[model samples]
Target: MEWIFLLLVGLAAGTLGSLVGLGGGIIVVPALIYLGSFIPGLDNLSPQVAVGTSLIVVIFTGLSSTLAYMKHKTVDYKSGLIFFIGSGPGSIIGAFINKSMNVQSFSLYFGLFMILVSIILMVRGKIKPLKLRSKYNYMRNYTNENGLETSYGFNPFVALPISFVVGLISGLFGVGGGSLMVPAMILLFMFPPHIAVATSMFMIFLSAVTSSVAHISLGNVHWLLTLVLVPGAWFGGAFGAKINTRLKGHTVITLLRVILIIIGLRLIYQGLT
Candidate 1:
């Protein structure tokens, strides 16, 4: 019965996670913790265990999301490849650090990180199109029959380094990495917001798989939970891809920022109390 319950939770988490580009961890971690608190037998595992387990399930979530994005050519392969170059090593280092930390410490730092991200998002909201109109103005111009028109390029050079940091955060928190990566691609890399989300999903797919493998070798994965979660993740990802086609770039960014703020506040409350 308890296993059945966990499977249901996984399904719901995956659906919401993919829809919002949150990755399953944001939803799955809280769901597991809630269930653990209420269920007697399963409560024996520590909070860290719950977090680790949720992280493992997110591997499926990322892959499923990535596949959906790939069908539309939303993923920018060059950017993903460069970001992977830096992030792959960084993930291992972050995981090692996670293994050594205490649960309370982890919670504290995680909350702090969430808050920091929230602040950045808020600030990003206020920054007008200044940069976009400046040296990176190439996004606003292009060549056509009339001589020139605005063209948006998924330039890799601008997207890579920031994406690496986003990946590092993924390793640290066991997230899909899309939360950070998508925003960076939009704000820093100058990709269209929908494209950024799709590309981030792809990057998350690779990074999550790499991190999950590392977690497995270190004895941090929960296979039972993962099996329960993947199906939902797949379907949710496909749905999200469908939704992305209709949303305008700025609207997606705005929605994502709002969700991030809400999640950040929740994490802060959890950590403080």
Candidate 2:
């Protein structure tokens, strides 16, 4: 029965995660929190286990999404590599922070923190039509099938800081970091939503890999369940990448905001009760 719960959570989270560029960790972490409370011996370790397991699952989802984006030439590998150069070390620092923090405090603040971040992104995301005041006008030149390319000009100044922040969050929370990275790329870098999404997945793959390794070193992983979740998440990721081509940027952002709000409220309610 418990195993059934795990499997169902994996299936539902994987499908939705792939569809939303979340890498499934957002869903998996909350579900673990909700379920672990009911298990006699599982409560104490649930969050760590959840984070570790989700990263393992994300590894598969990220790999599949990367392949799909590569097939379409949608990924900006150069920019992603540059971002990872900063993110890799940030993730390690974040892991140390997570290790020292108290879980109770983390849980109490997690949803509220994410909600605030989501609101900022939601408001900023509405500025799609506004002209960017950037020195690099070249970011407006590249074109995709949907014309979602960033101008050819790259800005490491903004990208570097954003990458470091997102990596810290990824390592701390076991999130895909897409929620932060995608929005940062769009607003700060003035990257098109499509390009932002693809690039986020690339960064997430690196973050997940590094974070997972650190978690594993601490003996936090659930190998059996990770195996079950990975294969399914891979397929789901491919499906999401394909569907993203069909969705409009505004529509995707609207939907993502709604989902985050709902999750945020749920977490707040849980914490309060």
Candidate 3:
């Protein structure tokens, strides 16, 4: 029964995460922590273990999503690589910080972060993309399925620092860091939504690798739990990416926002108790 629940959690996490470029860790971490309190074997779960296990699952989800998105030619590999330069190191730092947090504190902070991410999703569409004029910008054009080309660009100098912060949050919270990166890519970099999401998954894959290494070295991972979650997450990531190509996504986004808020409140209540 626990195994089945874990599998469902992984599937749900991966689908929602990949669909919105959030990297599924947001769902995995909290679910682990919640289940740990009641489930027999998981009763010993700590924040570190939960986070580490989630990051491992995130690696699979990100990779699966990236591959699926690559088939659509939406991933911006160059930008993803540049973002990794900063995120890789930042992930290490964040992993180290995660070691110091206790359950109550981690729950509180993660809950707050989830609420913030939900708010970001709510307003993301309303904000117009910013136009920045700079010689350092890396410009590119994306041709959609309908044969319309859209141009976008971003300055690496600006993007690197932001990605670093995103990585830090990712490692600390066991999230894929797409919640922050997607918005930044769309607003600051003028990336098309599909391109930003695809590129964000690529970066998430890289950052998760670094973060997972750090967690492993720290002895924070729950290997058994991670193994059980991977297959579901992997398939769900691919499924979500395929859906992204055909679905309007707005309805899903709305449902996701409500779920996040509910989860955030529940986590906050748990923390307070």
Candidate 4:
């Protein structure tokens, strides 16, 4: 029953995470922590251990989703690369720092962070898109695999700091940087929704790999539990990406806002109690 519960949690987290460019951690970490209370053996699991295990799960889930988006040529490698550079090192730094934090305090901070993220996401969702015709005179241009036109322009320099911060949080919480990166890309950088989601998965993969290695060295992960979640993560990731391809950019943002609100409230409750 525990295995089954974990697997389903992985699947749901994987699917939604991939779709929203949030890796499984936002959902998975909370699931592991809350679900642990009901699952016989997991009840005693530590929050750090839960976070570490979620990172491993995100590694697989992000990969699966990235590959799916890559197939559609939705990924913007150039832009993703810029942020990737900042996030990788930040992730490593965050991992080592995670070693010294008090668990309960960390949980409280993490929950507060989630609430903040949720509020920001909702506000961003409500904001009107800027008319960039005058500003972005030199339009970036491209076509997708089927030769459908797709293009957008953003300053990479402006994005670096945001990416580094995203990575720092990701490494610290085991949540994929996507939770922040996706919203930032859309709101701050003006990335098209599809492009932002695709690029986010790629970046998450890079950050998670480096962070996962750090967690392993610290002995923070639970391998057997991660194993149980792997299959579900992979399948969910693939399925989510497929769905993402079918949805409109606005629709995706709406879904993301809703999920963040739910996750943020739950985390806040957990922390408070």
Candidate 5:
């Protein structure tokens, strides 16, 4: 029963995470902690272990989503790589910080972060993309299936620092960091929504690798649980990406915003209690 529950959670997390480029860790980490409170086998689960295990699952989710998105030709590989240059070191720092957090504190901070993510989602659409003129900016163009061409660009100096902060949040919380990165890409860098999501997933895969290594070195992962979650996450990620190609994602984002708010409030209450 517990295995089944976990499998379903993994599937849901991966699907939603992949669909939005948020990386499934946002769902997985919270679910693990919630399950730990009452489930017999998971009663001893710690925040660090939950985070570590979630990061492992995120690796598979990111990989699966990135592969699926590749078929759509939406991922910006060069930008993803450049973002990783900053995110990689930031992830290492976040992982080290995670090692020192207690459950209540971790819950409190993570809940706050979730609220922030929800707020970002709420306001993301209202903020128009900015056009900046910089010699250091790298510009690219994309054409949709409808043959409509759009262009976007960003300065590396600005993008690298933003990605670093995204990576730090991801490492600290075992999330994919897409909630932050996707918004930054869209609002600050003028990336199309689809491109931002696809690129974010690509970066998530890279950052997850580095963060997972740090957690592994700290002995924070639950090997059995991680193994159980991987298969579901992998399949769900593929499924979500397929859906993404067909959907505009507004409805899903709306639902996700509400869900995050509820979860954030619940976690915050738990932490306070």
Candidate 6:
């Protein structure tokens, strides 16, 4: 039954994570917390362990999503690489910080923050667009694996800082940072929607790997739980990618906002109680 719980959590998290360029942590953490109440032996599951395990699960989901994006030639490898410049170290920092946090307070605050983030994302789309400012003087263009072309006029100064913050949040929360990264790429960098989502998946892969190592060293990971969750996450990611290709970008965004709202509220409730 615990295994079943893990599987269901993985499936739900993976599907939405892949679709929206989020790592499964956003879903996985809350799910695990909730699961602990009913599952034998899992009732003692700590938030740190849940987060560490979620990151491990994200690795599989990230890979599945990245592969699908690769086939579509939607992922911009250059962007992913650049984003990693900031994300890599930020993840490490997040892991270290997580060690010192008071779990209950962290959950409450993080939940509220997530809700705020979701609301911002929800409304940011409807607003008159803000100017895309790059600290760098010019935009760069690249072609993907299948010769699809896209351009980014970003100021690494600006972009990298945002990514670093995203990475920090990811590392702190074990969320893989996709939820924030995709939107930043689109809203801040003016990246094409498909490209942002694809690139974010690749970035998630990189960040998850780094974060996983950090968590492992910290003794936060639950390897057995990771094993149980991975298979379902992989399946969900693959299916979500397939769905991604079929649906419009706006559809993905719409779905993301709803999920974020639901998940965010749940987190808030969990925190308060």
Query: Which candidate has the top score in lDDT?
Result: 3
Stretches of candidate 1 exceeding 4 Å from the true structure: 1-5, 116-160, 248-273
| Candidate 5 accuracy as TM-score | 0.97
Candidate 3: count the clashes: 0
Residue-by-residue lDDT tens digits, candidate 6, 149-210: 76666678877998898889878887878767777777777777677878888898899899
TM-score winner, 1 or 6: 6
Work out the TM-score per prediction: 0.77, 0.84, 0.98, 0.87, 0.97, 0.89
In the range 14-130, model 1's lDDT, one tens digit per residue, is 655565566767666655655766767666555456556776777676677777777766666766666777667766666666777665566666766656655655565453322
Where in model 2 is the C-alpha error above 4 Å?
1-5, 38-41, 117-121, 129-141, 146-152, 249-259, 269-273
Model 6 residue pairs with clashes: 135-155, 136-155, 139-153
In terms of TM-score, which candidate is strongest?
A: 3
Candidate 1 clash figure, as a count: 1
lDDT of 3 by residue, 112-137 (tens): 99999999999988868999989999
How does candidate 3 score on lDDT?
0.93
lDDT of 2 by residue, 125-230 (tens): 4655344465743353557775654464356776677788877877777777777777667766667666677777887888889988998887768787777667
Stretches of candidate 3 above 4 Å error? none
User: Which residue pairs in candidate 2 have backbone atoms (N, alpha carbon, C) closer than 3 angstroms, thus clashing?
Assistant: 138-151, 138-152, 139-151, 140-151
Task: Sort every candidate by TM-score, greatest first.
Answer: 3, 5, 6, 4, 2, 1
- Candidate 4 TM-score, C-alpha based: 0.87
Whole-model lDDT per candidate:
0.63, 0.71, 0.93, 0.80, 0.92, 0.80
Q: Global lDDT for candidate 4?
A: 0.80
Across 141-234, the per-residue lDDT of candidate 5 in tens digits comes to: 9998899999999999999999999899878999999999999999989999989999999999999999999999999899998988998999
